[model samples]
Target: MNPLIQGLATIILGVGGCIGYFYASNLLLDKVLYPAKGPNIASNIRRANIIRPWLFIFPALLVLTVYLAYPVVGSAYRSLFNRSGDEFIALGNYVALLESPEFRRSFLNNALWAIFVPVMSVTAGLIAAQLSDTLKWGNIAKSLIFMPMAISFVGASLIWKFVYAVDSDIGLINAVLAGLFGAGPIDVIQIPFWNNFFLMFILVWIQTGFAMVILSAALRGIPEETIEAAILDGANPFQIFFRIKMPQIFSTIVVVWTTITVASLKIFDIVYAMTGGNFGTEILPSYMMSFMFRDDGRATSVALVIMIIVLPVMISNIRQAQKELR
Candidate 1:
């Protein structure tokens, strides 16, 4: 039961089981089912050649079915039931979610997150990318900007919590305000309507660095000859970037945008850490947590809703990436 021994045992069992399964399955296929040495050897071998790839993939398929696929299907199924899950109440949880004021508020907040975070993060990142590329010490500047991405979302939120603290001496924002204008200490997160944005800033601050890193690479990959030609044609700096480079790397931008959008849609950590979904900052994931244990149906229904919203963006991202490859 020792933690280290348990981990080692898990590793050994996992690896050993995989090896044993593959070996045993192959043996069964070759010796029993296919029997490549038998009277129907040629046909059996051909059949096995066709089936061999699936054999290799079967374990992976099983894992996916057990983990990802089952959970999705099960959540959808369970969402049909009532709070206790003892009675069948088809579409009941979804209806209740639609009726609930908190659910509506959470949905709106999630929408705000999905829209605001990706747009601001990607735009800021693109600008940072361009500026960093233009500046002499751009790499150093990028490193400083990107430092936030290295911090976990919870950590970043806690850091920002101090900045937004109510105490003038303890909080940086209040300290500066007290210095310049002698403004009173403010509990920023307690502010209604706007507090959602205040919470969102933590995520944006964390994700902006990720966007910058991605967009910087994309910018660098733009052909230099195109920029040179644009300059020869009397295009300004802004025109050269928007007209020339933007078109070239739009796919990468979409990839980054969708990636961030999906993260924002399912974001829980920053809200959970800082606000705990209080003060109108309740996103879907955090909203779902409010119903945890007490109302399994509604919690899962919220999860399903998050998935429904995110699935399309994910699919679009995939298709756009595929188009870029083509």
Candidate 2:
């Protein structure tokens, strides 16, 4: 079958299958199990209503089990083995990971990312949101700022590679430096401890727009009465923004912070694309990929560690979102 035709057929079959299932289930409830024609019609309707919700929820439950639950469980089980999965060495992979210097470096880089990316992105976003709202061409400015978000992480990393290239002729920063001061070309991504920050800036550049859009809506949602009262009380612009505005939208800030924190924790593409986990830029996901051909046990063990770290931050984001809804 042609690929496009196959896709269309799959869509049609999926829709048709869902319609058929619902129709058949309801028909069975009405005609066979709970007939409306009987003396117990009211009780039968009530019973059918109770079962109907579960029927609707069953598909979603199955998908969650297959996609989400199964992967976590499978990874956990796979981690309790030798490199080739021949013999059982429960928790040995994890113990090795704890002691490995490379793993420690990756963990430290990830920790720095978790702390630095969210904070910088949100701060830059807040500044952009505040400053842009006052300009006539603010939407245009926002569009340009957000343009990076549309680029894939690998594409963005590749683009930035040119800017950070070792050649002064090709790299933007080196060209400026060589033009002005006759300085030598520097590989920005190769500086050991500080190179982490240079890579993190890529994520920040991509995520800043996301943070801006969310925080912009939150800023717009702030009650005008409070701003008016603050102004009447002779609060400075800084005071109103920090004391009044920030307090009002602190929860939204936290939600944005946690959302970016989750992204930073799972960061892989930029590091992998730019440095291939070399020069001390190996975050957890990139580090995990380093074991792809060597061992399943070590790879899965690293993945489980990532899941454990992300779970709490994800739950906190969910809870904060729920609080927003309330």
Best by lDDT: 2
> Poorest 10 consecutive residues of model 1 by lDDT?
312-321
Per-candidate TM-scores read 0.92, 0.93
lDDT of 1 at 190: 94
Model 2 off-target regions past 4 Å?
317-326
- 156-273, model 2: which lDDT tens digit per residue? 9988999999898889989999999999888899887999999999999999999998898899999999999999999999999999999999988988998899999887999999
* Maximum-TM-score candidate: 2
lDDT per model vs. reference = 0.91, 0.92
Model 2 earns a TM-score of 0.93
Candidate 1, 1-326: lDDT as tens digits = 89999999999999999999899988988989999886899999999889889989998999999999999999999999989999999998999889999999999988899889998999999999999998999999999999997898888989999999989978898899999998887889999998888888888898999999999999999989999999999999999888999999998898899899989987789999998888888889999998989999988999999999988986876786799799
The per-prediction CA RMSD against the true structure, in angstroms, equals 2.2, 2.1
Q: What C-alpha lDDT, on a 0 to 100 scale, does residue 301 get in candidate 2? A: 96
In model 2, the worst 10-residue window by lDDT is 312-321
lDDT of 1: 0.91
